[model samples]
Target: MRVLVFALGEDDAPRVVQFARQLGAVVDVVVAASHLSSGAARIAGVGRVLAPDRPCDGSAEAVAALLASLASEYDVVAAEANSLCGDALPRAAAQLGAPMVSHVVAIEDGALLHPVQAGRAIAATRVDPLFFCTVRGDAFAAAPLGSHPAPIVPVPAPPAGDTIRLVRAAARHTDSGLTQARAVVGLGRGAANPAFSARAAALAEALGAAVAGTRPAVDAGAVPESALVGQSGRSISPDLYIALGVSGAWQHFAGVRDAKTIVAINSDAHAPIFEWADYAWVADLEGALPELLAALKR
Candidate 1:
């Protein structure tokens, strides 16, 4: 099967490469060249790279143009399941009249496998001959670097329309240190108070870690929208993940399930987060966070 994989951002390249190799297809990587180059390099092995001529940001116009450019090249299209490229995949599928699946973790038995019921249930869905799917980033390991380098090829033709320009961007700074963070500290609704946020931040700072939160905290204003960690939030798979007062709902679990190590802190010992966590600490978050911060300082 020939697969056209969309590399939405820098972080997306690794998993998309893995998926491409798994299908054993010639991979066509569609990218916004100026914004991302690693994605262009990662899938060079498959040897089909399609980049836009204009400065295409992740916009509806850009998506439309990209779809137009890539229409005839491949049989199946896959994307990194994320906000930047999420809306584009579905729209493209609808336009091409192809079957579409979103947030799929795997492809098994010749069908797409996705999580349902807030990630509590797994469902397998089969699409028609022409298929489009968005894949979860942490679901698979990136393709390993080989001894021989993959060849780089230029994409044919320029983009059709003018590039989508960003008027202004108020980039929200996240202390969750998510970009290159090796360790993460996640706070939930039980730690939604302002005082709790401060303590969580302190703990994260002391440990040189990033801070994340559950959807409830974001919805309740405990943290900024960027700090949420769940199905709707940013997906993280750090070396060490510390979940404070998080109940381990499937939505939240899916985001962090790939972490190498998990430590949970909650007052209730029976919380579901503990079941998946490597270590569970049943304690008051307010009390525990400060103590942990103090201890880590030394």
Candidate 2:
């Protein structure tokens, strides 16, 4: 099979390429950034790297057009299931009159396995050979760098046309550590009080963990939306997840289902989070957090 992977110039690009290569497909990458280290392509085990003359400027339409033009030459088109590629691949599929699958976790026996019903269930789907699909980055390991670098093939910029234009871009002030951290300290509704929230942050710092929160915590203004971990928020696979005063709603669990070890600290013994936790501590977070912090320091 011939696979075209829309590279986004990060770990996601290599992740998707690794997935395609696992299927024994001949993989080619089309980088959607202005400039990227060709070494990235080499490490991804790609046959060729198709880079644009300039950066993509966050234009999904341009990417869609490029994918649409190249769709016919390849048996399958794939990308990372991220905000940018998620928008482009569907449009590209529409242009090719092909089916599209998003958030695909595994490809097995000619079927795709993906999360359904807000990640409460898994669904298997089959698509035409000539189809577009996006792979979940966390599901696949990064492709190893090879001894030889892949050839860089420059592609022309997308023509300017009637597409939504980005007037300006501003960087958001959110803790990216929550997404990249191996250890995450999660706050919930129980930690809604300013005092308790501050303690949570302190505890997180003491443990060298990134601080995150549930939707309720975000709604209560205890943390930014980027720190929210739930069905509508970012999914993560931290090595250790420490839930402080969490109720353990399914929505929240969905985000951390992949966590290797879940430790819950809540006053209520019967809290739903305890059901999913590998370790449970029944104590008030306001008091317990300080003790935990002191213990860790000692």
Candidate 3:
């Protein structure tokens, strides 16, 4: 089987490429070379790297056209499940009249395994050989850069007529820290107190984690609006998610269902977060914060 990987962003490229290799032999990779620091094509199991002559930023229509054109040669085409790829891949699939899958976590029994019903259950789907998929970044480890660099070929951008153009982007919109964080510290209503919020931030610092919060915590002024994680906010799939004083609402949990490990700390043992958390600490945040911080420091 031959696989084609579409990685327009540097952050999720390695992980998406690694996942693609698991599906089949990754021969050609359509990448954003200027976005990467070094030999962006120096990834393990890749042969030729196809880079665009023009910039890939906000070029969803062009990328889609490129993918649809080359997709016939490969059995599977894939990318990480992000906003850009999410926009492009669907368009490409539609053009090819092909089936597509998103948020793919694993491959089992020759079927793509993805979550359904807001992560309530797993669904095994089998698409035709010529199919498109977007992988969950946190599901696979990033592929290490290989010593041998693949040959880079510059492909011309197709005519993307009548496409929405990006004028200017806010710095905050580009901050994908929470989605890319290996570990995340989530603040809830329990951490709304100023003192507890301080301790939570310290804990996040200790863990080298990005700090996020539920709607209530953000509304209570415990965290910034950018830190909010829920249905209305960004969905994250960090490797480790530690919640402080969190009572899990389904909307909030939906954003973090892809997390590898969930640890919820709340005084209420019956808190909704506990039901989903792998580890539950039934303790008040006021008392638990100091001890936890001390242990982490030690």
Give TM per candidate. Answer: 0.74, 0.75, 0.70
Better of 1 and 3 by TM-score: 1
Candidate 2 per-residue C-alpha lDDT over 162-274 given as tens digits, one digit per residue, 9 for 90 to 100 = 23332111012122444457899898999878999888888888878988889889899997655677665556788999998899999889888999999999999999999
Best by TM-score: 2
RMSD in angstroms between candidate 2 and the native structure over all alpha carbons: 4.3
Query: Which residue pairs collide in model 1, if any?
Result: 176-210, 176-211
**Rank order (by lDDT, best first):** 2, 3, 1
Candidate 3 lDDT (Cα, 0 to 1) = 0.77
Candidate 3 runs further than 4 Å off: 37-39, 59-63, 160-182, 187-203, 212-240, 244-247, 254-271, 277-298
Overlapping backbone residue pairs in candidate 3 total 0
Residue-by-residue lDDT tens digits, candidate 1, 3-62: 877665555666777776677777767665534544466544556566655445446456
The 10-residue segment of model 1 with minimum total lDDT is 166-175
Prediction-by-prediction clash tally: 2, 3, 0
